[model samples]
Target: MLIDKPLPELRRYRGRNPRPADFTRYWREALRELDATPVQPELVPNREIDVPGVECFDLWFTGVGGARVYAKYLRPKAPIGRRHPAVLQFHGYSGNSGDWLGKVPYVAAGFCVAALDCRGQGGRSTDAGAVQGNTLNGHIIRGLDDPDDRKLLFRSLYLDTVQLARVVMSRPEVNPDRLGAMGASQGGGLTLACAALEPRIRRAAPVYPFLCDYQRVWEMDLAKDAYAELRDYFRRFDPCHEREADVFRKLGYIDCQHLAPMIKGEILMYTGLMDQICPPSTQFAAYNHIRARKEMVLYPDFGHEWLPGEADRTLRFMLPLAR
Candidate 1:
């Protein structure tokens, strides 16, 4: 049973969510603030996951608000004269940078890999937690009640992605022109955000991205799982939906759909029509706004979980850039 619009309609779907009038200006100012912040980066060698051809290091950098960010960095051991491409990875919501072994393939493919541990999640990265609202279920609602949009948790998280890109691009062994990004679900959303905020990202692969079309998800009554916090916030704070417009408007500050138009990188989105956790329509809401060279791999019967060979395909999609 498909849970969203059919493929034909999905192609033409423009989404029902409202894009804030000052969306572009808001992000421009945010990035300006992020750029002004001092990113004092540090790298320490890690022996636990060392392998044959890749050097593993614990990467730390200061992000916006002075919170420290963490990432697992693997630089490939190529000839001294050779410069390698790099990939920045974002993980699913509430998750950390995955085990070191998972990044080996990219390292073996002559790519330096840096997987981020998002702020306040299941990773070593720190969450400053100075918001004004319910900090209960999800990061989406962390600063919803704050008078200032700068206090939003996702604002900092999104800026963290940009800072990591800057860090990776600064490496002497890496080619800044060949940097790419990959992630699924929340990571997928961050992938979009990173590419949008960091124009240097040349390629992006986002699988079933979350944090898009929040109003559409709410109207469809599908805000239960990863979006459960959205529903819970309303139930507890605005029981009668008095300030609904303001709530969604505030969320616009972090919505990936609004950010999509800023992405200049080539995009390849992986989506399953049956993905209830992040519905197909919601995924398309962001995809439709992408003005870059882009394509989508549709899984007609798949859900939010793994799609067979998706990893292989993504690797192949990025493989051409190695040359």
Candidate 2:
């Protein structure tokens, strides 16, 4: 409620960002390109961390634009021929996959966990830098000036998630039918993208997701922190606001709200009503468009930070996948 619309109004808000006229065709072509690219997955054993009842590895795969993507993979030791459930964990903006110990809780429950390190961020993943545009500030506007919309950095990042999911699902010990995805902030947005592009994901939990309703964030004047790149992009490139609508329309291809309708997995979204970083209305914009079975948990007084007990709630929400 802090600067956003009231809770009731937020629930009814669809979004203000424009969806590209070729949205579906655009994504279909992206998927086809991903399909053509060889995953070339490699899992190198991590000999440093010794956790009882679990095996760990540094997973690497080739993503679109030939960038080498990385992820932390952990699987519970199980009887031969037994396949277990798996979860894909994406990290926040500018963060790498977290410590291996953080993923043990899922492994302890007879599940496999793969934490992705988004390309070009604070991780081992390599950025191909193939796009033609201002790469000065953030990935959100990485390819804004390119004639080809597919050059957008986020387009590649979103495909990386799907490719990772496919590699994880191909593992002999993982049950493809029981895969789930979760993350917060930028990671949360990726979770939605992964689920939308790979419909086989059984469940998805996105916590106060970023990369949603860009125009809404700009209009609300809440684009300063995590979304600061928006302001920087305008100041450096289109200071006169002449290309505002065009810029936002191009961004629509990467917006989570536009992808929400394509998600087939059951979704459990978390939102902090008082959040200013990713305002409540912006979060609701994506949440409201989800056509899948879904639920939203709101914190009346919380901001964009931690939501007490969210970890436990997410664990319980995803527990059904193990069965």
Candidate 3:
């Protein structure tokens, strides 16, 4: 496991980041804002992919702060009248909803699929850029300098997942009760967040989620690669570590570990013990806090990269939703 903690320790980890006292109230107000913002969803037919059994479309919806979020939507072609099970797929950080062909397996299994393209990433979504801080390095610290913690970019990003879920659920052809979500890395974190914010999510599979235990990452000095923004933020904004506690306290608003307890769905989390990018302990921090029906798949020899048979296992885990 290299420098990663032992399995026993990882399982018991509760995370090191501070949890804001008003964490629940903060999200309540955020949800209130999302409720007021109209999600104007539009679907444009995609003619490029020549798949036989599925229909594809470019789905667009207005997210929080009036940003237009995009998702690649696909559904079975033959089953038109009845509603079908649905799955929401989120991508890794700085990435977009992948090609339409990749989502065909769910459609083939008679499931409606929507893969979100996070705002301001490598996709069609638009970033409002309305925050008041340094936006140079990454999304993590985009709004750290703002007095209002609501300005945090991840707050809006997390709310976008909820908005997307609502839009998918509103579709006449989607069975809301059978809805599931799955993702890796940043997407994994968003999966946890989505399931947390929207209790309607029936199943969730998050593979080595990021955005948990920020202070732990910094403390361990593993903030170089995916968490480089943490190092950058401290160096550029608070070099003297003066506002260290306050900074992490504000970040507590977006940490996935704090949000895990809010999930009401069944969860299947995957963690690679040798992962330095998002260390195993950090992933377990959120996983351990989940109060819902949950299970974990640990890869003893694996790291942040791909784990063998993960795709097949994920497909099988989510297959029950199709019933």
Find the candidate with the highest lDDT and give its number.
2
- lDDT tens digits, residues 1-323, model 2? 25788778988999999999999999999999999998999999996789889999999999999888889999997788999999999999888899999999999988999999888888888886743222335888889999999989999999999999999999999999999999999999999999999999999999999999999999988779889999999999999999999999999999999999999999999998888899888899999999999999988989889999999999999999998
Could you estimate the TM-score for every candidate? 0.96, 0.97, 0.97
Off by over 4 Å in 2: 130-136
Stretches of candidate 3 off by over 4 Å are 130-136
Please report the TM-score between candidate 3 and the true structure.
0.97
Clashes of each: 0, 0, 0
RMSD to the hidden true structure, all candidates: 2.2, 2.1, 2.1
Q: Write the per-residue lDDT of candidate 1 for residues 1-323, one digit (tens) a residue.
A: 65788788888887777777888888889999988999999999998876899899999998988888899999987778677899999999878999999999999998999999988878888776533222335699988988887788899999999999999999989998999999999999999999999999999999999999899899889989899999999999999999999899888888898899999999999998889999898889899999999999999889999999899999998987788
Candidate 1 regions exceeding 4 Å error are: 130-136
lDDT of 1: 0.90
After the best TM-score superposition of candidate 1, give how far the Cα of residue 23 lies from its true spot, in angstroms: 1.1
**Model 1, residue pairs in steric clash:** none
